[model samples]
Target: MTTKKPVVVELYDEIVFPDPSEAFLSRVQGHPAVNLPRLPAGVTLPPPIPVEDASKRRKGDTKDHSLTQWFTNFSEADELLQLAAARQRVQAHIAKLRRQISLIDGQQQQFKSTPEQ
Candidate 1:
């Protein structure tokens, strides 16, 4: 029988809002003085710039081989790199511990086999 790996799925939505200044203008320019409805709790408003415009601006401003830009702009990449390094370190430590445990077990077996002098 073959075991199948589980598939993981993630969903994300991107929202873009005009800058605060623009929102402010919209609020102030409203001809009616009716009280505006409140937004849902924990719901955040997006910035004024459109998502496409923001992406274009980021691409234009960043250059290849820029460490700060890479670190700041690509958190998923940075996190993966960090996780890889951590896994390597953990594996190394586990191997060392295994060797130490084996050595201790061998010593214990040897001492047990030797008759009390």
Candidate 2:
């Protein structure tokens, strides 16, 4: 005896694939799939700024004008200046060492000319 099993079927909404000619026609007709939101008149985001203004707020009457209200504490600047000075000193020391090496090389050359008995 042969038994027949019923076929299971799944149905879905009809999806139309766009024709190449239709796509070109829609593109030529100025149909955009996604549109950008428009901002209201006279509204804008604030301008960018640097890190030095961390402790202050924007000031002055002009639209983009700004100022630093508080003077930076001297200790921080002094420390930075000291660091720069130390770097300069180290560079000078390296230059002096190079000069000393050149002098030693010259002296060795001079001693090389003297004959040993």
> Evaluated with TM-score, which candidate comes out highest?
1
| Model 2 lDDT-worst window of ten | 60-69
Candidate 1 global TM-score: 0.45
RMSD of 2: 25.3
Candidate 2 lDDT over 12-66, as tens digits, reads 8854333458777667556666365566799664544554663364332233233
Clashing residue pairs, backbone N/CA/C < 3 A, model 1: 17-47, 17-48, 18-48, 19-48
lDDT against the true structure, each candidate: 0.68, 0.64
**How much is 98 displaced in model 2, in angstroms?**
1.6
**Among these predicted structures, which one has the highest lDDT?**
1
For model 1, how does the per-residue alpha-carbon lDDT over 1-117 read when each residue is reduced to its tens digit? 446876779998855344558767677658497466676899655534555655665343433323443245545556678999999999999999999999999999999999997
TM-score of each: 0.45, 0.35
Q: What value does the lDDT take at residue 81 in candidate 1?
A: 86
**Cand. 2 TM to true fold:** 0.35
